[model samples]
Target: MKQEYEALFTPWKIGNLEIKNRIVLAPMGGTCIFGWMEPGGSHFDKEAARLLLKIAKHDCGLIIPGIAPVKDMLGGKWLYQNKRKFAELAEFMDELHATGAKMFVQMTAGFGRSFALTAPLAMLAKNKALNTLAKPYIDAEYLTAAPSVLPNRWADDVTTRAITEKEIKDIIYAFGETARLCKEAGVDGVEVHAVHEGYLLDQFTLKYTNKRTDDYGGSFENRYRFAAEIVKEIKDKCGDDFPVSLRYSVRSMTKAFQYGAMPGEDFEEIGRDMEESERAAKFLQDAGYDMLNCDNGTYDAWYWAHPPQYMPQNCNLEDVEHIKKFVDIPVVCAGKMEPDVGAKAVKEGGIDAMAVGRQFLADPKWVSKIKKGREEEIRPCICCHSACFNLTKHNGTANDQDLTESAGMCKCAVNPRSMQSKKYRVKPTDKPKRVAIIGGGVGGMEAARILALRGHEAEIYEKTSELGGVFIAAAAPEFKEKDKQLIAWQKHQLKKLGVKIHYNYEVKPDSLPSADEYIIATGAEANRIPIPGAADYAMDATDYLLGRKQVGKDVVIIGGGLTGCEIALDLFRKGKNPQIVEMKDDLIAVKNMCLANTSYLRDCFKTNKVPVYLNAGVAEITDKSVKVNLKDGRTVELPADDVIMSVGYHPIPLLQAAKNVHLLGDCKKVGNIRSAIWGAWDIAMKI
Candidate 1:
């Protein structure tokens, strides 16, 4: 093990509890020991327990699973009512304790206005009578109720009503009961699901959300009264010796409703500032909290809490370190935290521990691998959030996520086996066959790797010299270092698996390789606009991203999708002026992409003053300008030194129908990495 990382391996104390190491598995949305968002009473989720137990065995010091609501979402039963689940957890904890790791059940009060409203739920909330009818099963009104009346985060039309004092008291009582139950279940401690992320409890704490004139609003103490009461209740019920951790956000980092402040941007905070956070930290500690599991951001500024690749490494360290001074209790920082940096902070008394969330979903053995000085073998999390916790929302949309993803939240995009152990696990096949994978992109490589793991002869044919196909171009941005790391990791895996690769060998349909089965992962070609002068003036998005072409001082990007928006941001960062023209109503207006990732790009564009023309289409391209037609039937010519086309892609498969031939990735359908890898897995498993 590296000497610099020794501090991370050292024991740490949170109240009377002593953790074996400084690595804390921060809670995610779906990996709760208790089921989340299901239409039934709370029960022990074996799948979630299996994943957590694996992490515990991997040398994680403290394990915190996803938020287990104090009240069940569907049945509206208090969590303490489900004593059988706690009994099951008690048995599970014996196995977990054998691994020398402590566990914490993070109990959430509720989402309130931050509840990610789906289209069907939004409909229920809009009609009072329908909501009343649905209250017995799935109460949309109660679920969306906030500290005060506020607009729902995902749905624009739905307004959350202010929660009553009676409901607040009920929830506080529930927290105490739940914490007591967790302690009885052999759980080491409990972390409050937060006075962070602008959830119900956070809504009560923030002045922007809590407008009540009564005991729970206005003044700082009043605003935080609900949170203070929760810890006090838990301490009173479970005894003061039982540690209680608070999920604390050092600053809100929000500017307005549905708007977030970008990193390094100068803006007036509309949510919690440092001054109040300093005072609140001390107050909450004094109130009975044992530790602070800290980060920054609300649901509005979600990128700060659930950071994408665009966010810097150790994004929340400085703020978390500063907050540590205000409270004597241990502080743990999350949000894109790097291990070495976290280790240094732990050694310097900057922070007590480092909390990591999504990376565990990407690679459960990362800690063990790091401890063995095999960091390169660890799979990297690209922070795409495509498969995991991608509750997407855009203009004129609700949550907009697929129902399956909404229910199963913590599945990793890169590593399929994170939450899904049974379905995606590698098993040796008795009947081995030679598999030829066409194209050396992510999908092809993944297919080859899986086949080789299944005791089959697997080989990849690449047209280009490199393995990463369009993803190489996609990951070329400076901010996409993790993506680059992923590519390296994949290459290393392929080499280690002994998968054969033929570079600069493009396979035509007529000139196919001699294999029992053929997997086509030829990828996609960029769609070019048919406008006049486009061929001469406009370059493909890949051209710019791959550094094959350069853009001048002023640039116009056609298509306001994720690729186009990211390019615009990249150009803006390079001190080049970039404008966007889109036919859609909003940028990245697609389902299954995380708001945390998209919102950062959207907010960055808005903050940097990058011109974005929505509901607009390109009419023609010129050498120095591009003519665009607006939604109002008006044509305008914008000055442009260069034109970049990022409209979309179309699959160009080698063969559509052939015996023993299967198509995956962009060759089958033009989609993101999630589709490509999962598609590869589906086909590879069958073969």
Candidate 2:
């Protein structure tokens, strides 16, 4: 074996089991799941198995699946019922084992407070009428306790009912049963999904959400009982030698602390703070857990856990460092640990192992790339949270949205090979062809790279002196450095594939060059907003942002989409309080930014005293000032040194008369980073 690859290939032992490598595939779900007792009844879905198998083939040391319900049919749950199908699952597991990786099924309980009913469940215990109204929305057996008693935050009217002693016993039994099933299914190990703001276990574990008066609640000892009991059950049932890991969040920055919504005041729940994480971790280790999977945040107080693009990458590293003090067992750190950071974490003793969730989704070959000393080739996750958290709000189910739309499977911003693994693998053809891609942005770069990799002669023509197109301007805003990672990764891939690049060159329909095929990836430009005196005082957001033009002091930014909000923040950073006026009901309307990151940005605005006027439209612009119309039919005049317009962007003019030309990127439609990249991927695959 090559010396550079030795680090990843070395084996590491956990308890009695030895894993082939140091790489661990962080857990994630790509399809809807339920308990065995739900409406559809839990059955093995072959699609999920296939996806897992694909991940397994990547040859990571450990692979952890997302939450597998232990309570069977606990209402509206997507249960795992096909115990007999273990043989099929085992085939994938065996394949991974063959590759020197160990597969683990993650068992979870306590999803009662997931939906809106969690609020009502709490309200029901306080008042009966609210329970009756919430009953319609409640799903499954809430096990022994009601959703309200579950530790989480929701609208003021919602609350959870307390759990009885018998219910606690039932919860313990569920873990044991779930563990036994995994042991029989031939998994190398089992992981307890006691993290996040999920079902029963966490409901009782988190202090703010757990309000029990019994031995299971109130004090730290009482709270530790829930997770401890489950861990004991798994060890007892799975046998002492079985490798069992416990995943838990050390920090609970719930919404109550960040931005109290509905009926509560915004305040962090100090009860479940870092100190609590340390205590829980030690308790779990003592209870016979072979390892600790360190995770953070919850759905109720979503941001504290998920964070967002604005939050620094590796936000949870500090928490991991804190947990390491109390536990002697291996601590696996998760939450946006990229390749370099993860590799550094290993060297710095931040944790025993690094868990990658969104990073792997952006590129399944990440670990492989890092091991091969190809660090720059690793695709970076932008942490946009569009496909992960934001989409779930609209579809009601995370899996339904991810597999169908949100970059299916993996989440590379500029690569479409995510969930479409089996459907779209790289293949070679007998005959190669010549291809021309016009544009140097994400989409055009992706197309050109893919075409060249497939043994085709690919040439790229970018109209500007640079290649990134609007992305160069997009990265100009505050905290959008990760977006640059996407551009950098794409540019690297394009260069490695030997794709020819021609900058500052535009293509005309009338004057064209003959090739096997032409892909029009001409990106979009800032929309011309019509308002009097706009030209004199206003500057396009892209121009001012990309450094193509400069803005004077005390600026007014028009159009409150993602670009505008980001620009406003950047301006704020520069000591300028840019007022943003939007015609829409909300700011940053189009993008699915993470709630936690967005909350932090909102806090920044408040901190900096920057004004964001939603539902306010620009009426006209004067050289000295601008007039605006509020949604309430009120008009106001505001003085401004300059105006930055981010109303919208239109496709670059790709001579429509061009024949045998396929259009992609901003020119095809004004879409997101994923759309542009996937457009290129799809077009190149066909060519």
Candidate 3:
């Protein structure tokens, strides 16, 4: 019987170029630092080129870069500053073109978040010349324009200056120059990234930010003029032969904002009410856009934009159909789009093409796996946002969890060798070694699974009753239940590879069996913070959220990292007034991994009036009250019936005694679950 997905596997074409299949690798940011610039621009690293070529050979018809900065001198908000010569970029472009896959570059203006990073870099350089007091002015000045004028809900009371007319002109010119460069680089096309609630484009589009009374503000047509002119300029520079794709979302994941400031009560409302979105699409298409990539949500409201499993897969296919009816040009749909779901969308004629993001991260050989009908073998994107989203947000670097540290290299979560496909194949080793893995946490489980797959007799000794380590903490949050699936999948894979697992067997380093080598996966320990009344009132958020213990009515949580935020949410779910106090100005530094959801969670907390005090320190703790030092250097007292300590966790250093031992997961370094698992996999593969 012919499969419904065969249509998706069939040959297709865009403009004069021909392609093999309908599956397209949506232009996604490959690395974190190049927020608005292509890695090909300045990061002319060999590994980046190799990664791109490997992705091209994966049977995907069209492959789009996450983004490429379209600037001349490279001075934009969050955009990447390219110092490398144009010749280097041209060489990378030639290699991608030779891979038999159509290539496009995603382009966007800088978002306010970019300033949060660039501000500090500039401040550091200035501080070396000046002093500490002068540093604040530089930081404040950058923030004033990047986020303050833009009005970000995530930013901590930072002020920004409104962009002047001269700055706007420079931006338009930058976009034009970038397009010209992309054309010179010999790329197939450029996708205008006016979505994902990132950069200058989305910031201008969201009405909540554009309150200025000028040509760039007021009505929908006026707000979209800058983008329209930029798209027009690109078309004029690249010519009609080069296909230009425009990626936009009708809803802002942030809450009330959407592309061009549209609002969506539900999915259907987003499509129906956003006349400006359709108008902008028509304007760009009329101006010469060949394709439209539609998705839902913005960054301010984040969760809706990068919709996870909590929302249905292919959640915005209907939005694509709505726009498809209005425009004659091809429509591309993205947002948690699965293989079968994408195939069905194409088969049913709901959309012309399918754009995938996290799926490619989960399995880069996604198109190849689908072409061969090995759907089950394709590792699905669990959407933990650890690798892609988190890294992009905080550090501005691509998640190299599974790949080597070489710059511009693309990596995956499940398959460590996905980006390094050319370097290593799933072939049996020359000589199989008997491996002993202690502790069934992420690191141990990963090592055991990979070693067994390499034809090694791998035996895992779990000290506790379960295999998962801090991954269990993922399920402790109100919206992180999906993480449990990933942990279960890892366990299932380990068992399928014929790994020997022994639970509740505590083995010290000396008591362990002798093998070729040993892997110590003994995870991390919780940091115990000293306070006056800690013993009676303080409990680790992990312990409280995991249902190991109950929290009190008026609870205060110290530390505002990802762990603390989740604990607060768990307390909120329990109908408690959660007060989170952090020494830092911002709540969580690792927010990129869980963008939209974080916005939603923050809003929920604020709406419920849950107190969140920043730049506050706990001066004293007692049974009846807790004293805090405010940013103004004043002390305030609040009742602390209960307290949760989320200060931070430390590695369990007892593993140092074991000879030829390796550490993985939070035990070695405090990081996401992907890091621990991938760390284990890498070490085991070499062993």
Tens digit of per-residue lDDT, candidate 3, span 383-498: 66655554323222221122222232346655566444555455577888887787887678878877877788889888778878667866656556446666776777876777
Span of 10 residues, lowest total lDDT, candidate 1: 35-44
Model 1 segments more than 4 A misplaced: 657-659
lDDT per residue for candidate 1 within 1-687, as digits (tens), equals 999999999998999899999999999999989996676867899999999999999999999999999999878888898889989999999999999999999999999899999999999999999998988888899999999999999999999999999999999999999999889889999999899989889999998898999999999999999999999999989999999999989999999999999888789998999998999999999999999999999999999999998999999999999999988999999999999999999999999999999999999989999999999999999989998889999999999998888888899888888788989978889999998999999989999989999999999999988999999999998999999999999999999999999999978878989999999898889997788989999999999998999889999999999999889988988999999999999999999889999999999888878999999988889998999999999999999999999999999999894779998998888999898888888888888
lDDT of each: 0.92, 0.67, 0.64
Q: Model 2, 313-418: lDDT tens per residue?
A: 6767777877888988888777766545666666666777777776766766767776667778777777776654443321111212322333233334544556
Ranking by lDDT: 1, 2, 3
What is the clash count for each candidate, in the order shown? 0, 41, 30
- Candidates arranged by TM-score, highest first: 1, 2, 3
TM-score of each model, paired residue for residue: 0.99, 0.84, 0.75
Top TM-score prediction, candidate number = 1
Output the worst ten-in-a-row residue range by lDDT, candidate 3: 397-406
**lDDT, model 2:** 0.67
